[model samples]
Structures are given as structure tokens and as C-alpha cells.
Target chain A: MENNNNIPIDDLTEEFVVNIGPQHPSTHGVLRLQATLDGETIKDLLPVLGYIHRGIEKMTESLGYKQSIYLTSRMDYLSAHINNQACSLAIEKGMQIEVPERAKAIRIIMAELQRLTSHELWWGSCAMDLGAVTPFFLAFRDRERILDIFEGNTGNRLTMNYITPGGVMFDVLPNFASSIKELLVKVKEHLKEYEELITGNVIFQHRLKGVGILPRELAISMGCTGPVARASGISCDVRKYHPYDGYDKLDFKEIVIDGCDSWARYKVRMEEMKQSIHIIEQLIHNIPEGEFRAKVKGVIKLPVGEYYQRVETARGELGVYIVSDGGNKPYRMKFRAASFSNLGALKPITVGAKIGDLMASMATIDLVIPDIDR
Target chain B: MKSLFQYLKEVFLGFYSLWTGLKLTLYYFTHPRKEIITEQYPENRTTTINIPERFAGEVILPHDENNKHKCTACTLCEMACPNGSIKIISVQEESEDGKKKRVLDKWIYNLGMCTFCGQCIDACPQDAIIMKNSFELSVYNRNDLVKTLNKPGSKLKEKE
Candidate 1:
């Protein structure tokens, strides 16, 4: 036993450290946050990452323009289509290829479907993180429908290397649009149930409200995008603002709120899901009959330049920065992950917040660690 | 004085919202048609993948009646695989006109490292490769998984 000095040991002064993850289920994937706590109040928060770093950027430099699409799937395993789209767009930019209009529509549909699927999973996981168990299955109930749609065309659920350089690897299946329309009805019905199960719950609101308060100015300064930023009333959705892949043709709105809390983030995601359904409904009917891909040259030699492609995932903005060296492969691929940038905001937000609020706060932050690591 | 009533009203409204959620989820549970969505994998053996005609899959050398393949043993597929999943050994044969033609000696397709990306299928110039709708590619023995389609001393006869 050591004798303490004249320092008073209050709850604030009584120090304790907790390692939140590396293997924790709520982390979504291998992300360790070392937090210094004083009686359930997080004092200092530090994110420890790089557990799932696959050196994808280095691996991409060796692969050809067409070969690098598979590597994108591993970046954000949950939203592989968005990752594939970003990479394909960069390659298309480098090689100066314009995919046909029909391909653009298909790409938009696939991306929106991916957005819906990713948000569906997020709804479930965020509910589970907040100690609500039943919504996980409810969200997956909708998610499996989306996965079957993906598996029908792309051949897998999670990692779809379907998007190619000039266009997609393959054309949309014959009944793809009709089948998706069928799933769309179910998704809308299920979303209504989700709103009931999680969104309106007092416990969920109590867990989320005024928790992880990221103010608008700080969010802007940190370059946060997607739902996290949109929660703070920042309307920076790439689909609406940048308008890639027939996004301009469709009618949709970016869901934004000024509440600047976890509940605001939750509301934005829920509303975004509704908007995604609306977009799918509008786009699926007008799918045109045309070629899905163009004839790309045998050997792709990218001109010496840099190309940047950004897409809004369920979590946040995913930036793919590619530099071409007039060769078959990319010279450098730097991913400016939304998770990485959003995780930086945690230390400022989590300070003085209760330990229970940390999970709610982290869930709102919505980090995909492999995206950060890559 | 009015602010106190407003705060109380909000508190009551929050409870109302919570009640709304509970009612909706309970309704779903009672309506069991919305609950289960699993398709039994083995039981539904007649599942339709609806594979397109142009889909690139496994690299088959197009075997004919004489047990001959269309592949000229160019070993292009071996170079295309990112994971070194394909290995092909070829031997040179002299034609009657004294021109040398490469004949396949050993063809190795390792399912262990194959990513099924269809790159090797595209690299073959001789429309010799096609991805068959064979999804049941699982095997207990690792050695049994690495299939060699071309046997030794078999000449690759051209298609009619």
C-alpha cells in the first residue's frame, strides 16, 4: 500500500483506462480506442488503428487498370460497390473513356442498392450497439433481399468485383430491374417497421440524444461528409452535388438536420434510406436498352495525370486519389477515408461524456476501420 | 410559466414516440409472413443463377471427341492470374514443315488460390476457356481440388 499525497481523489481525479476494441463486436471491425475514464466519464480518447491494413495502395500499383477493381472490394468490405465505382471512375478518368448511358444508369442503381444495403446493416448494428437486439435481425431481413439482388448479378454478397474500368464487368441480368422492383416493395415495408422498432423508441433516443455532439463548424473544418456531416446540417452529398453516374437524371434529396447529436445522425440515416428507396423507384422503371460496356483496348496505358473520385457511403465520404504514370498500373492510390477523418473528431466530442454515451457517440461516428486503414 | 408546460409536453411526446415504435415492432412479430426469409441451400438444388452467355469463368481447353484441346499451350493464362493460381508446362513439337508447335505437358489449376476473377479466362486467345455453371466446387481433400484437365501424350485436335 502506497500513501497518497495531499491530492484529493474525487471521481474526476480517480483515473482508469479502458481498451474498447481490437476484437470488440460493436467496433464493426478491428478498431481499438484507448480511453482514459473517470467514473464512467471518458476523459481522454485515442483511436488505435492499422490492425486490418492490407497494403492495398501498394498492391494496386502492381495490378493493371482492370485488375485493381478486386482490390477495391477489400477496402470497404461492407460497401464494395461504392469502392468499386470510385476505382472504376478513376481508371476511366485516367484512360479517358466514357461509359454508355445505359451503363451509367445501371451503375447508379447498383450504387443506390449498395447504399440501401449498407444503411440497412448500419441500422441493425447501431441499434445493437445501443443495446437493442431485435432490430439487428429486422435490418438483416431487409439486407438479405438486397444481397440476393447483388448475388444474382455480381455473384457474391459482400465483395462484388463487378465494376470494371470502362464499365461493369458484365451487363445487368435480363430480369434485374424487375427483380429489384419486387425487393423495393419489401424494403419500403421493412423500413416502416425499422422506424417503429428503433427510431421512435425512448431508450434509443435517450441513448442517442445530446450524445456525441459534433457542431457544424467543427465538422466542416475537419472535412467530414455523408450522414455524420449531414446530421450537423452540412449538405455535402456527392451524388447530389457532384452528380456522377446518372445521379442528375434521378430526383432525390440529401437528408440534413441541424441537431448536431447522435439522434440527428440516426434521423438523417433513416430519412436517407427513404430517399434511397425513392431514387430506386424512379430509376428502375426508366432503365434503357443498350450496351452495358464499351470495347476497351487490350493494353491500357494511362496518361500521366492525377484523378480523384469521391463517393458517399453509408458512413461518410470515401475519396479515391489515383496518380497515373503513363503505364498499365496506377502510380499511387491514396484513399481519404471518411472514417479516418470522423474518428479524429471523437476526442473532442467524447470528452466529459458518460461511458455509455461513448458507444452511442462512436456509432454515430460510424467508422469502417478497413477504409481507414487502406 | 409557459416554458414549464412546454417541457412537460415534450416529455409526454417522447413517451408517445416510444409507444409508437413498440406497437409497430409487435405487429411485425405477430405477422409471421414478414419474419422468415431463408431459402434452404441444399433443398433448393434447382436454383437459377441465369448466367449470361458471355460470362468469363473457368479456363477449359475445349476437349473434342479425340480427347484433344484447342489450347496451343501458350501459357498466357499462367501470366494473367494475380495469385499464381494457374501453372502450365508445355513442350515443343516439330511439325512436318519444320515449324515448332507448343504442346501441353502439364496443366495445373489450383482452386485453393484461385480468386475466380476470370482474368485467366480472358487471357486465352483460343476461345478455349469458359466458366461452367459449376458452383458445387467444394471438396474435402485439398489435393482433389487442384484439377489437371489435360493428360500427357494426348494430342489437341482442332475443332471441326
Candidate 2:
């Protein structure tokens, strides 16, 4: 109490710091953020990740191409399909394998569905972060249908390693088309309801509008992608920029909002879900009938070279960099997570924002901590 | 004084957003009878999965009434397991014709180490291993988890 600002006399200008999590609900999952506060405003913030790091990259080097798909599912549990897609694509590209057209369409449908599912959950969870509990339950309600479809096809709900290297692990069931089509309509209707519920809500806007603003320049410098970068008016969507798995042929808009705030991020994802549904709808009737898997060599051995592949997961750009040395296993595997780049932008945006605003800002970043840690 | 109106508009806008959220919750609460999506899991235990099933669970080798298990002691499951969860000890015994026929001495499956990846089932060449839907795998003791599939003298008198 030596100074009027209640700063210690020795450290008069310096701020007090509080560790936000390794367990806090605000963190989403085991993310520790050390925030230095000057009064109510965040002066400086440092995000401490790797508490949940299980050496997934090191584990991948030991596992074969097929075995590594299961490990990829765990890295970003929310968007396992995307993780699996990236890994499978890397192996497919490395091995120069040709996946069937029917398989490509199926993979696109599943990937788009996963994007919608991930965004829906993100929207609901982000709302919950701002103390709106209703959207969380509503989002899960829609997510249940997606999980049902996943269980119908892949036998697992969240960790769907359905898509494999040569093609998908299995073909879409006969009823899968009708069920997914029905889900598209339901998701669309629910999305409109969600618009009324959260998007147009007054409190949501107040909490989000012009808060946690990341300018286009800063976002580019940090290499932020997905909704975070999109919110800041940067067109960095991997699906649009570099199309994979028939995404090039599909008709969909890249949802971008120049608001550069939490609201923009929310808006981007909400619109992206609609676009995902649009892509899913176009692929429904035209699901070509052909062999699901192509002729992959009995044992996969990548020649000595490096291969890189990226896919737009719900969080952001998921880049898989693989180094092979004429072996069955990858010599080295590196994952450039979307969340890692998004989280890097956090300190710049959080500083000068209130502590309450910090939570809103972090939520807008849409981090999957496992993706960051992995 | 003009800024006051703009400030008030923003304030009203914020309140309207919150009200919209509340209205949604109200709709769900009122529409409670609209197909309760949550399955009462433990109570309603007979939840059948959709077809083309990919349920990753425990591996069980089918046994007939005479207790003849399908395993031929090939040890392919042992080779397939990434964690070395499955172990097979082959017992060679002299048949009626004096030929040394291979039989499972002890089929050791450590549930603790198993990932339930169904890799063992995929590796079994004899169609011996099949993944059962019995997912209730929790046990009190770690020792109880090490399940042995084949015991001695449990083989059928005549092969099918």
C-alpha cells in the first residue's frame, strides 16, 4: 500500500499476475495462462501449454501409417476426422496412392460434417464461456445427430478415424445418405434457431463486439488461420486456399468477418457451418458408387523425402509435416496446430483488455489445447 | 447529449441479445416432451447400434459346448498387438495316430495392457478371434484382468 495504485514500493509500476488454468473451465482444457494485471486490465499474458503433451509426434514415429491414425484422433479429439484426414493424406501422397472417387466424396461429406459439428460445439462452448449455458446444451443436441451418423459409419462417436490413407476405412452405409440429408435440414433449422438465440442476442454482442480484436496485420504475422484469422479479415482457410479430398470441386463460401472481434470469430464459424451444410447437400445425391479403397502396397514404405499436408480443422490450419527414410515408419512427424498459432496471438490482444474480457477473448481464439500440446 | 442515445442503443442491443438466448432455453424447457434425446443408459441397457458396426471392445474366441476354442496357437495376435497384450503358449501333444498336434497351452490376454484396437482380431488368420460387444471391462483387481481363454483338456473330442 506504499503507492496510490496499491503497487509495492519496490515494484511500483509492475503488475500482479494470476495463473488462469491447468484446470479452469475458461481454459477449455488444461491450458495455463499467466496474466499480469494492471488494475482490471491485462498488462502482459503468457500461455503455458504442454501440461497435457503426451509426445504424440514421438509416438507417431514408432507407429506405422495405419496405427498412427488412431493416435491422430486423440490429438484434437473434437475434430478427429480432420486430424485423420491430414495424416491419411500425408501417407497417401507419400505412397502415391489413388483413392476412389466414391471414397473422396464420402471423405468430403464426413470432413464437412465434422467441421460443422466442431463449429457448433465451439459456438455453444464459447457462449458458455460468456455464462450463457443454454446454447451449450443446444449445440450438443445437434452434435448428437452427427455422433449418431459417425457411430453408424465408424462405430465411434468423437474419435472417428474413419478416413484412411488409400481411402476411407469403410464405405458409407445404405441409410447413411438419407440420415445425413435429414441431419443437414435439422442443423440448418437449428442454426436459424441459434441465430435468434445467440447471434442476435444483445448480451452476446455486448460481450463480444469490438472485444478481443485481432487486426489483419498482426494475425498474418502470427500465422493464425481458421476462424481466428478469418475474423480478422484474412482469407487463410486451407479448404479454400489448398483444396484436398474433392474440396476443390465443391461449392462453398469462406466465411469471413472484418469485425476483428470475438463476435467476428463467432459470426465466421456460424456462417461456416451453413457453408458446410451447403457442401454436404451438394454431395448427397451425387455420391458416386465405386470401390472405397484403392490398391495400396501391402506394406507402406515411404522413400527418403519430406511431405507436408494441411487441412482446415474446426480450430484452424492443421499441418502434418512428415520426414520418411525409406522405411515403414516415419523418421519424423511434426504437427503445426491451428490452436498454436491462434494462441500465439492471445498475448497481443489480451493486453489492455479487462480480466473478464480475457475469458471472452480466449474463447474467441477457439483453442483445442490437445492440438496445441500435441 | 447525442452520444447518450448511441450508448443507450448499444445497451439495449446487448439486453436484446441476452433475451434471445433466454427465449431459446425457455423453448427447450417448455418443449420437454419433444423426443427426449438422452437415452437412460444404465436403466435402458438394450441400446442396439446401427449396422456395419465398428465397436472396438474385448476379443473373445468362440467356444463350443465341448469347450473347443478356435485358436490354433499361431501367435499372430501376439505379433499384431502394439502393446504385447496377447500371449499364446502352444502345447504339443501326441494324438491317437502319434502325430504331434498343436493346441493352446494357455491363451494369455492381459486386459490391462490391451487398447481394444481389434488389431488382434484382424491378424488372426484362422477366424479365431472376434470382438465381442461386452464393453463393461472394469475390474476390481489388476490380476483379474489377465484372462486366460483356453484351459487344458477343454478341447472337443472330434474337430468340426
Interface Cα RMSD per model, in Å?
Answer: 3.7, 2.6
Q: How close is candidate 2 to the true structure, as a TM-score?
A: 0.91
Per-model lDDT:
0.81, 0.83
Question: A1-374, model 1: which lDDT tens digit per residue?
Answer: 65576556662277789998899888888999999988888899989988998998899788777777788888777889988898888778877788987888788888888989888888888999988888888888888878877876876677878787777767778889889888888888778778777777776788888888999999998878889899999989888888777788788888889999999998998898889889888878988778888778755778899899888776777788989888877888888777788888888888999988888988877778898897
- What candidate 1 gets wrong by more than 4 Å, as runs, is A1-13, B1-19, B33-35, B41-66, B132-145, B151-160
After the best TM-score superposition of candidate 2, give how far the Cα of residue A157 lies from its true spot, in angstroms: 1.5
DockQ of each: 0.42, 0.52
* Candidate 2, chain A: TM-score against the reference: 0.95
Q: Give the B-chain TM-score of model 2.
A: 0.82
What is the per-residue lDDT of model 2 for residues B24-109, given as tens digits with 9 covering 90 to 100?
Answer: 77877899987456776676666643333556667777787877777888787786676778888887889999998887788889
Q: Name the 10 consecutive residues with the lowest summed lDDT in model 2 chain A.
A: A1-10
Against the true structure, whose lDDT is highest? 2
User: Model 1 chain A: which ten-residue window has the lowest total lDDT?
Assistant: A3-12
